[model samples]
Target: MQDCFQRTDWEVFDHQDLENHTSVVLDYIRFCTDNVTRDRCIRIYPNRKPWMTEEVQSLLTARNTGFRSGDKVLYSAAKANLKRGIREAKVAYRRKIEDPHQE
Candidate 1:
């Protein structure tokens, strides 16, 4: 939890709320979402406060310094690996469910 809080780059959220919201979105996205709707969803808004908070995302345009290129590359690789692992796991899970002898 301490490590997660220290990682400011990621959106820290409650596990239950995040999981529920994401499941809802993913279920809906399978059918309803299109390019325009996706764009609208990506544009984050805060109801109680201003959207342009300095501690988070602001209206300030970012200049690409290319300083974090290595970090970005590593993150991309990690994400790809994670996705592959998830897909393989899901496939194995479905196979086991279909044929319990393989379980």
Candidate 2:
């Protein structure tokens, strides 16, 4: 990274105005950083429910699969189970938050 910065011809932006020069410099820095850094897959769910757990996620997937299978009975059962699981998870999370020393 340091070598990249040293080798870059910053004089190329000297002819540009202040705003354009700043933008170009920032873009160059970002390009160099991106080339030198390892890419990573970071999952960020900003709107995800705080009480969501792996069990609840699995139940949700099952419900979606049942719905897609065109089986009304199966979908209904899966939906019910998902709802129950979500409720239980929420209650458990609440209890845990309210009584941190319990478990």
Candidate 3:
């Protein structure tokens, strides 16, 4: 990247008008950065609920799948399990927050 910038003809953007020259230089820099940089995959976890654990997430997914499968028995069971899991997780989280030393 440094070598690419060093070899650039920066004098081409030296317009007499200050605004045009600044805009051109900024656009060139953005173009070079976009082309030279590699794309990255970043996993951003949502911050809506801190008590939402991986097990709870999997249970939620299972509940949804069961509901979509058109089976009343499976859906009902999954729903009950999800409700119990959520309640347990919330209680655990609250305890941890209120009494950090209790562990």
Query: What is the descending lDDT order?
Result: 2, 3, 1
Ranking by TM-score: 2, 3, 1
lDDT of 2 by residue, 1-103 (tens): 9889888887777844888888888899899989887675747589988789999999999999999999999999999999999999999999988986577
Evaluation by TM-score, superior candidate among 1 and 3:
3
lDDT of each: 0.45, 0.90, 0.87
Off by over 4 Å in 2: 1-45
Query: What is the C-alpha lDDT profile of model 3 across 1-103, one tens digit per residue?
Result: 7877888997888799999999998898888888787676746568748678788898999999998999999999999999999999999989988986575
- The lowest-lDDT stretch of 10 consecutive residues in candidate 3 is 39-48
Which stretches of candidate 1 lie above 4 Å from their native place? 1-70
Candidate 1 lDDT over 1-103, as tens digits, reads 3443354343322346877768765654443434223332345455633222342221121212222454676556555555555566567657765885553
Task: Tell me how candidate 1 scores on lDDT.
Answer: 0.45
By TM-score, how accurate is candidate 3? 0.53
RMSD of each candidate relative to the true structure: 23.3, 11.7, 12.0
The candidate, 1 or 2, that scores higher on lDDT is 2
User: Clashing residue pairs in candidate 2, if any?
Assistant: none
Query: Which residue pairs collide, candidate 3?
Result: none
